[model samples]
Target: ASFRGVLTNGGRGGGGGGGALLRRSSSIRELPRRFSRQLSRRRSSLAESLPDTPAGWAASTAVLSSFALGYELRLQRSLTAPPLVFSQSNPRNDALRETLSRRRPGGRKGILTRDIKPSLWVGTRGTLSSAAAYALPHFGRKRRGECELNARLNFREVMTMGRDGASVGIDWEVPPEKYDSSLCRRKTSEERQSEILEGPIRKPVVLILHGINNDASFGYVRSLMRACTDRGWIAAGYNFRGCGGVPLTTPRGYTGSYTGDIRDAVQQICDRTASPSVPVFLVGNSLGANLITKYLGEEGYSGTLPPNVAGGVSLGNPLHIHSGNMSFPWAQVLGLGVRKSLFLTRDKWSQMTCRNFRAAFLKALLVCQTIGSVDDTLAPYLIRNDPVYPFAVTVGYPDAGEQYWDDASSYKYVQHVSVPLLKVTAQDDFLVYGSSLRKMSHCLECPNVTVVKTRCGGHLGWQESPPEEQREGEGRGFGTSSWADAAAADFIEAIIESRRKSDKEEEAIKKAREEEVEAEVAAARRRRKEEEREGGGRGDDDDDDDAGNAHMERRSTSEREGYIAARVAAAAAARREADEIRSRL
Candidate 1:
């Protein structure tokens, strides 16, 4: 029956008896299928009229949403509204400068995370996706254009490990056997790198690092890239060895603890993408989190950061002390399974993988000297080789235990950090252990760290699709994190404001203290004169005593007030600038 016929009959028919009612119910059941088919046909016609492919339809929708949201946000950010404020004065965009800095910042350590991560667990299931303008994508669409893909790719080595010259590579996908000719440099290295940084195109780049067993073109990578792009960021992920279309440049694939490789990769990408002043944000998830945290901490101590790197975000990191330990065991078991599946035994896997990159990994493993307690049982792949097993056993660690608690620990780095940082994690992540994460996070001393911990949603799973019909245990929520809206973009912008305001507050407090000291001196002089006039000789001594005590208290109070006032002044400045910027816009 026609969809309209069911509709018309359902609306118009009169059921005189129970039999008639039953008939009506049967017809109602069939209406749904007919209605769906009719709706699909209508939608297809509408889609054709709109003039784009299915992918384009999604892209267009995302763009229009971004534009509309951006326009509204810009409107709200009017130049004459509250001035965007910051302590550091940027005359060009003073108003916007203020709007960015006022956000609170702090990060929970990756090590002490179990409890804190729960607050961020967005439920895993909802209308996985729908047709509404701001609707989430169902599983199907997220698989395709999340990441732009060409056949395959690889990169030149940036660093070597273990003095043995074993090459280590860490990326989201498998390294392609042959590096793409298009990606090769015919130009001088400097010119090529410069071109990548100052591109023929201007786009906000999100350099992504992957977790265990993942690659650049995986669904998660694509989703994040799409989400970032949807929110107006140019996102890309690189392949590690043996995971995506790429083959292992070295015989062995990557491990979770590979910090040097990831850092070098970031440095290279920064060379390619970040101009001296272009904002660069580092984003890492899960295993990538451990590597990134260590990288940031190390960079913090080194005191030399690439000026192009603006900030970073670490999500669902394996920060718990137990994480690395667990990973070794887990990978050993997996290696066992994979070896059996691939018909390679422990003895053979060593001789085979040890040839090239395995040494680099083992060298990198030396950096994790704390894991001395890990034991030979976890070294399934290396236990056989006297060469490999002995190295694992003899490796020196920064800490006494083997969990890598101190080397990659973000707690120590917080005090040294000045960069803006965003830390996202799930509390209920059974894998990472919430308690350890919380301990580490609570101890991180950086004022620029913002820890967002959810109560549900295991691991990288978070959804922000209108809340009600969102997915469970998915990162769909963080996907909408683009600068199209104030909140999405503010994390990066806020860090800039933080430094400026800190400087401003310190200045204001200095001024306030000076004024207070001057006032105290004047009052002291006035009281001395009054005492001489009133008490003669007796009033002089008593007055002197009173003056000294009062002066001390006043001076102390002024200093305190000065510090507080400086912060207040910075805040006021920020507000005025933001108001002005908003008003103008």
Candidate 2:
């Protein structure tokens, strides 16, 4: 039957109503499929008009996003959050600003306040801005090799056994062919022997510590590692117990406050490097930042830390654990991740000697709904009951939860951090309280510590719009998709360069001193020769001349001995003073 006739006359009769209705329903169902097919054809045409290949599409999307992000950033009224007010003059802050400015591509004119220009959308000033940071990757596309979440580089693993037989793994980034070739140099026989006895000249080490429940595999961590290696540095990531796919060697797990393994790993690195000249910069992200700050403060206060630790950079550091208000949702999510880690390693827990403790801990973990609850369950067992370094856990609170948070926090010992420390925090970081940062920064008396507060940069999410050169991977130069990584590399470079320059100046001074000493010795010898020629005359017999020569020789020897002894003593004193100064720096 014709379609129009069927609709109008109901299949030409009153009894055909049910058949017509059935036909109508079937037609209605088919309409959606027909429409979908038409839409697909149109979509295909539109996609062809845009970019056909995946790479081409990605490139186009990136270009469009960059333009959009740039516009948003430019339209913003204020670029940064409110400046942190300090009670005392903070020269370190000024120095840090200058360092960041200088390291920028165009020097001071690149950006205002700092080089880390947070993205306009994700970096908005809000209470949940930090939470937005985790969602940033979905909005913008990271470059192929930069901040790749799934790409795992082949890193050489170094395992260090702690005092308690537990192990911490360090994944070292293998340098490119260029770095290896560049590192090669001719050495003197003595220098070669010294290197053989000690170790090869180590590149300045930049060791990264990941956040809670995170590892070397994290995109951010790997990106930073890549950034370091790009700068010709020895980059490494420190994995906590059972992290980075390493099996848990012991029943014990890691806590924020438990820095014993970190201490051991660093000590091992220092030992392996042999030369104290090889600088080691410890960079910590999130929980790792807190760990580093606490560790540095503790070591700096106690005077047990190594001097080769040149500096520290703490990103998204939770200065005071209790100060920040973590949303229940975030807390629960983090708790779940922790629980998952525990579940994956349930076999290891089963082997634990304390059966009752393991049973209760596992049970508590299964029900943990917040990070606070997780810490409360984990801290006492990991730290207070630690078999290796029980006495090391000193920071405490009356309540178990408070104690875990307080002990883990860097707030207590932050003032004692002696190394040149760059503490970067975002005002909008959800995990960290801005007030705590402000208060801590205000009270900070350590001239070596610098606190940088950005208006945006949610948590560790300092993702900025990549510059044209960087986006194209052309002359990008030692940077990752992350602004924090770039800033850190620049800071480290500035420090290393400054140190080298200072060393060069000192060397010049030493050379000048040596030259002056030689000149004085030469002048003295010349004067002695002149005096001997004048005093020994033509009127003297051979025997008299000989006796006179012998007397003058003895006098010359005595004078030379006096000069040598005085110079040696002076040189020794100078060396002692220099040693003291270097140690302090």
In terms of TM-score, which candidate is strongest? 2
Where in model 1 is the C-alpha error above 4 Å? Answer: 1-202, 251-253, 323-415, 441-443, 467-490, 493-585
The residue-level lDDT of candidate 1 at 81 comes to 17
lDDT of each: 0.46, 0.66
Q: Per-residue alpha-carbon lDDT of model 1 for 1-585, expressed as tens digits?
A: 554455546545542354456677989999999999999999999877784578978988998998876864543333111211112233423443334433323321111121211111123221121111123332323332233342222233223443223344333222112235657643444443334444532345566666655555554554554444444455556554344544334443444443545555556556654346455666776666656665665465444566666677676665644434455454454344333322222232345533433443343343232233232223332211111101132233324334334434444344344466556654445556454365554424555565555443345544332322222322434333111112234544444455457669899998997787777767786778786788654565566767767887876898799999999997787567446633532
Q: TM-scores of the models, in the given order?
A: 0.45, 0.67
TM-score, prediction 2? 0.67
- Backbone clashes, candidate 1: 97
Q: Evaluate residue 180 in candidate 1 and report its C-alpha lDDT on the 0 to 100 scale.
A: 50
- Clashes (backbone N, CA, C under 3 Å), per candidate, total 97, 1
